[model samples]
Target: MDTMRDRFAPVMTELLDEDPRVAVVLAEIGRDGLAEAARRHPDRVINVGIREQLLIGAGAGLALTGLRPVLHTFGSFLVERPFEQVKLDLGHQDAGAVLVSGLGSYDWPAGGFTHMAPGDVALLDTLDGWTVHVPGHPDEAEALLRHAVAAGDDKVYVRLSVQTNAEARPVDGARFLTVRSGGSGVVVAVGPMLDPVLDATGGLDVTVLHATTVRPFDGEALRRATGAAGADVVLVEPYLAGTSTAAANDALADVPHRILGLGVARRELRRYGTMEEHIAAHGLDPHGLRRRITRFLDGAARGGS
Candidate 1:
């Protein structure tokens, strides 16, 4: 059971060897993992030595030349620190690249709040034409990574994290997979939140849908799952809470619905503890989730908004 980041290196190295149009730009992180690839193809596998902006800039430059570039770094530095460059270079120029991020919202609690990027997806939401993939397992990560690189000229974000499900669900790079069917409500579990969501929703009459590609958000699938007016939806994500709530609201706009967004909260915890502690603090663990989800569902059923 390798971590998503652990699988990313070798999969990327293989992609570099197979595709002449594929390139990787790094910012001094994950260098050791892809060192062999860098040695094999110096021009294609590049490390910009801790310059986040340059990492994106170089990837953008490669994209402009018609080569697919995959940018790698921690979520905060990759998306937040160099956001201006991402906005102008990729979005403004219409150049496309694959931005693969590691160390999700609170994967490394000791790394401090600076390393945690709960708003990465939400920030990308401000931009247009970006595909975001949040894979729950290493295998799914590889699948999504290959799909993004092969898509060519499409801006894609593949978010990788240490938090993973015990098993890998089938991922087609798009569309949410229905894990369970129930009549009361639908629980949309994104990426690594699947196991916790399933655990939390145990015995509850709620349909569960697993999402890997979240940007193009499968509203149609959600529509099918709920199948009636005034549906109740709980989005269990590993990033910022309510990040996808608006998207869900828009998806169910025509119908009356209630949504509960659960994930990392807005405030910084500021304390360095175990990742499990952070999870518990954010109420994202199975125990907290069960309590919250049950309460929400109960309220909705009782005619409470």
Candidate 2:
């Protein structure tokens, strides 16, 4: 199965061929995959060398001219490095672009902390009116990419990751899909975190909801899963821990609800190791998820915080 990043070039190529208004901007990252696209559409496919800020600025400039721009880079450089450009050129100026990111969080642990960006979503959360898509599989990524390109001047972020689930869940790029149903609680799995969340919640009486488009948050779907009065909800994300807890709390503010957010911890692991080690250290593996999810539900059942 192809990774999400692997699907980007082909999808973008198709878009560039079909839509004359669609353009791509890069900062010397993932240029090899898009070389053919650049060859075919030299003016549309732009490479601004290592200038991450220029990449975003160019994309925003394209957007200002009524062209849809898709910007590509590692999550750290894509969002963190050019954040001011993103906030001003895009958000402030009302210029929309599709920011497609690779190497989510710790996909390449060997690349060190500089390459990791677990806080990308959280930082974007500070801004308003941005749609974020964290697809679990390449198929979903391709679909969301197309959706964003055709979105007509809406700010969108497509977060691509090397860490993918064994299978792709059907994602409409808008609402959350209900994977499993139960009465105990609801387990909302975002992006690639679905498989592990399913494994962790197996045999346990809890509803499992798969989320590919996380920006909208899908509070209605979550409310339906947890019932009107509210109940325990565990959020298993591929990025920062407790990232969506505030949104969950606001969604359930009308009733009594307990939420346990689980994902990559804020604390950095300085020792270089495999990505699996990073995942384990962050307690995102199935075993760790099961332990934490079970404990949280058990505690909630006992009327504890």
Candidate 3:
């Protein structure tokens, strides 16, 4: 399956060619893929080695100088490692950069927690007005990248993971699109979480709503989807568990709500294995999601035991 990260490099290269002001700053990730772009536009595509902090700071500096900058690196290093830079430089300084992060959550399970970033989105949410986009497919990633790069000074985060959906869907603003509808409850799928969520809720009576842009969440659209169904929402994210629980609550707070938040575990499992193993350990696999969702919705339907 082609990943969003795979398409990220080429799309960025295209951006570099199309616009001279478009610059890409990297920290030894995706360098090979963007080699030609770097060679052609050496001034635009720069590799700051392993200095994640400098990678972000340089991007901020570029943005401050009337250039649209983009920073790319592993999720953990990009968000967790140079977080101070992200928060202060780009965010606090009011400088803007297109942060294209790859290897989300347990995408590189063998690399262990050092490489995994289950809380990238949560960290970004701490800053003000950062647009977060988690594309389920390469096409969506490409479209969103173009949109963000051309957006001019808007802080944008495009998260890419190894897991991908079978196909691409239309990229809408922040409106939650219905993948499969039902009368039982609603399932909000974030990014790559769509495929497994669909599989998990396949046999159940539930409405599945897919969300690619999470931050600046379309609460209105979500409210419309919930309607009068008691606001039983299942938010399936690829990052830290319960990351979007608060957003869901606020969206459906007008009505009494029961939300089941599912994603990477908060506690460090300290286990290193395959991506599937890590996902299973976090209870994010299809069977596990189905069991957890059914259990929660069943209990909710019964008015809680």
Task: Supply the TM-score for candidate 1.
Answer: 0.98
Model 1, residue 37: C-alpha shift (Å):
1.3
Q: How displaced is residue 17 in candidate 3, in Å?
A: 0.8
Off by over 4 Å in 3: none
Q: What is the Cα root-mean-square deviation between model 1 and the actual structure?
A: 0.8
Model 1: lDDT equals 0.93
lDDT tens string, model 3, 130-182? 99998888888888888889887999998988888888889864667788878
* Per-prediction TM-score to the true structure, in the order listed: 0.98, 0.99, 0.97
User: lDDT of each structure?
Assistant: 0.93, 0.93, 0.88
Model 2 per-residue lDDT tens digits across residues 1-305? 88999998999999999999999999998899989989999999999999999998999999999899999999999999999999999999999999999999999988999999999999999999999999998888998999998998999999999988998888888999999999999999999999989999899999999999999789989999989778899999999999999998888889888888999999999987988888889999999999999999889878887
**What lDDT score goes with residue 138 in model 2?**
86
Show where candidate 2 strays beyond 4 Å: none
Runs in model 1 deviating more than 4 A are none
